[model samples]
Target: MNNWKPRVSMGIPVYNGENFLREVLDSLLAQTFEDFELIISDNASSDRTEEICRSYAAKDKRIRYHRQEINRGPAWNFNRVFELAQGEYFKWVAHDDIYAPEFLAKCVEVLDRDDSVVLCYAKTKFIDSEGKILKEYDYQIATDSPQPAERYRSLVLVNHRKHAAVEIFGLIRSDALKKTPLLGYYARGDSVLLVRLSLLGRFYEIPEYLFFNRDHSQRSVKEKQVQIARGRTIVAKFLGMGPLPPTEWFDPSRKGKIDFPEWRLFYEYFISVKSFPLAVKEQISCYLYLGYWLFKNWMKLVRDLLIAAEQLVRASYKAQKIIEISLEKRF
Candidate 1:
């Protein structure tokens, strides 16, 4: 690793992503903006991922690849790249996602001109596994508001039907990002991180559709739900600790009784407001909005709990059937 610093640091965290890893890297390498370093954090992938990354690194000095000895969860790998970044601006790139050649250049230009904007991302175009264009994502969060409270409301209160967390891939000021907790080891961790960022500064959206987010069966969100169903606690595994309180879900320092992720998100937002320089009335207004959000999502929360219980019942039935078949065969 050389000491040369780049204006932008693009981090790609992957595990067993050899299928589209080359295409992702090719897109990054062909960027119009060349003053950047590509950081690839391989989470001990057992596939040909290591080989592909190593080959690319050998050819391009701008690419620095690091392999973990053990397979950590996606959250840890995602944050690991940021910890290893040494640039003025940073962006997280998914292994299966493709970017336009001018994606980084346009984002960098926006950030260069705007001092108040902490994050800058282009509009998104969803694509299938075969690279065919799906439809354009239309959900928008009001992150460009000059008022911190408005930005917080936009990020936390809005309900996006599709691609809700795509803005997490945007280029961000390193200083602003360093101040906030990177990513939690929970299901909606990316959404929570975006909320924290909105509390810090405004976000700028580039008008062009330069971001290509791929949707497939093997996406991380689906894989996480599968792991949860298999009786694996992702947060505990990622932290390398036993079960923790709900407070520690977002704040690693605190130990309190268990709570839902949505409640914890509100708690995090309150903490952010308290930590920053907001007026007394503005702080109250933000808290009021949090209360309203809770009221709005209460039905959804109950529905989600019912769905979770149904899934648990189904999994238990499957396991019991498997055991019964084994016993019959032994007899």
Candidate 2:
């Protein structure tokens, strides 16, 4: 790549993504909008990921591939691509997802005409591992609202998994993105980031379904225990707290503590509103909404705790059984 700058920067953060990396890259390369730079941050994949990326980089001048010396977690890898981006608009592409050739062109057109729009994404269709269209996903979050409070309420109160958080992969204004913490190293961090961006400006959604999000078993959102562990690791890294016990890590009863991921999300939302410029009425309204949000999600919090407890009990029972079998064999 020369000293040329592009209007948009597309970053794909992959880890051991050799399976669909080529297909994703091919889709990106076929984009009608060619004046964009594609940055691939490989998280030290031991698979064919490095080979595939390097081969593409050699052929395409716009493609820049960087391999980490060691594997950083998904959060770091995702943020690294944006940090190295050199474009007015930036987007994160998942290696397993497919984008239509016109995805970039349409998103760029929207962002160009609307200065008030800080982020733009198209409707999403969920695809299976075989690339078969599963269903069209309807993420009914109110990010499109002109009112910041409405946007914030939708982002903060709505269940992120239900909404799919597809907007996290949308084309974002680099300036607006820089103003907020890109992504925190916690579960549902993408949702919190979206909330922050909604506070900054409105999000525009293309009516067409140009983005295809692949839903598979390996997706991070599907792994509840893994998410808990990742959130704990992040908390420990930042707070200088030694590794947290499993009980403390996933317990919603311990609100206001670093271990509670949901509480941390609300705290982040509160900080975003407090730090930003808002009218007194808006501020009061947001705080009131926050209370409403807590009240509304109280049962959901209990359900989460029950699920976590069930998982823990199952794990402990499995461990005890394994030990018993081992003892019986020894005897």
Candidate 3:
């Protein structure tokens, strides 16, 4: 109830995050900007998450809490909270991550000054489950030397989801955010949103450290390999199946050997474009990724075709043998 202008709505969606719920709430309460509304949506967590949310809501007049009847997963819960937000600027908080005291204050200042920046994010510190600081993600996409358009092209063409900062805490223009449908895709939903937003306007970069992203074993990336693998399928669906380009290839970042299929699928996604020039460039980049994605299975597509042909030949031979045997028996 402080006498300040409300500028941002922060959505915090939780599911069984009891261990770190109190700390996260306390950090939000300590923010320097007292004009924000904290919207907490509980995804029917069986843990003490509901209790913690209710306790905070009782104390803070600006805090709003709602509990869903069924667990709808993180994407749906995130969209639900965002759909209910009332502020001009929107920021999403994860169940386990922490924010600096001045995080919202600084982000709001930038957004207030500039009307062109649709999204703004600060440097982040990686932390463990116990809130122990591990390292900083300062160098990921912040320092790319090229212009925003070129840098964005490189990152998006390569499908740099892991290298791109997680979208959990960035403050976004609510109007711009509302333009894109959230939670429709399978994997890399945040990346897709960021790319879509970038398509509209430039992104504001805050070099200061303001947020913390937690790395835990229970993250969906680890528990669901099949779903993660299917991310390639999603990329393929978007890329489309077309012919005529042999030059486009993907040059995956060699620093990490993770999610190789996604890298290739990223290429396929790009190559599906109808433009002749973009189609060529995307094809070459896709090839670079293909080297990594189809490395051992380099000949998978060809191998499958060859195997099918052999099977057809063998079937025909078997039929001929059966015919000869029947003829001898009749004679």
Candidate 4:
């Protein structure tokens, strides 16, 4: 009897997110846009997450809940939701974020009107755990530029401290999004996803601030704090002037491995440039922009190498200690 099709499919990937899950579900269910389907992918949460999702799904026909048998990383769960989506327009909703009632209606309107615009999002404000607005994201990227290279360049040199590139959470044409790798299991993979998407088509940002990003201790970017609490790391000791980026948050399997996150960004950006079908001049311009990026991030690039060497050395020492203990036990 279920023959209804939705114009938009929204997916929320979550893990142990009981604290804010109810509020997010309420906001989406209240949205002015009624044709959208809501998909929740639970990453094997041990909390009351299952109970909450099941209860919501029971009440709403639009809500679909899928629980993982085992916890993969956030990136894996993010992709899982997209795979399950059947709508023309797709949105990856964060478990902790809130949206205004008109958020989805406005985005779908823009996408419906313009074929060139591949993604549409509203301006965002950062909110604290108590739902108080901390500040608006005033950072601008010329994402609406008609030229692909110009859009790509605008996203490449972002002041991440000021701009979160939250547009990646926006409504995107499923076809355009499918062209780029849907978020990778590497650090800063979400950033790469936005940058690459800019090459495919223009992005539209609604003037009003309709997206509210939640900032709390449980957020993934703050997962570094948990790592720091365990002990000092090669990245913290040798790398200069920053908190450790959340590698394990993207993929828990990356824990204790030697990772060149900055280097990976450089590689992926280069690949994005090479793979796209842009004019020769625009392609050259994109490469020049990357050169500028390397000039700015050369220090971090070097740090990646240093951190890798230190990690390898520590891993070797640990392995040697284990072998010695094994020999003593045998004797």
Quick one: best TM-score, which candidate?
A: 4
Question: What value of lDDT does candidate 2 attain over all alpha carbons?
Answer: 0.81
Best lDDT among the predictions, by candidate number: 4
Sorted on lDDT, highest at the top, how do the candidates line up? 4, 2, 1, 3
Per-residue CA lDDT of candidate 3, range 233-308, in tens? 3333344422111111111122122223333334433432321223455446534533554554445344333433
- Residue 255, candidate 4: alpha-carbon lDDT: 73
CA deviation > 4 Å runs, candidate 2: 221-258, 299-331
TM-score of each: 0.81, 0.81, 0.67, 0.94
Model 4 scores a TM of 0.94
In model 3, what is the error at residue 193, expressed in angstroms?
0.4
Q: Which lDDT tens digits does candidate 1 get at residues 1-331? A: 7579999999999989988999899999999999999999998999999999999999999999999998777778899999999999999999999999999999999999989999999999899888899989878778899888888788778774454688999999999989887887664778778888887889999999999999887776534454354334443344343221233333333323234554555566667777777788778878888888878866544433444455467678989999999999999
The global Cα lDDT (0 to 1) of model 3 is 0.64
Worst 10 residues of 1 by lDDT: 241-250
lDDT of 1: 0.80
Consecutive 10-residue window with the lowest summed lDDT within model 3: 243-252
lDDT of 2 by residue, 1-331 (tens): 5589999999998888988898899999999999999999998899999999999999999999999998776778889999999999999999999999999999999999998899999999999888999999887878888788888888877864477789999999999999988887665678888888998899999999999999877664424554455435333445443321322322224423334455556678788888678778777877888889889766545444544455567678989999999999999
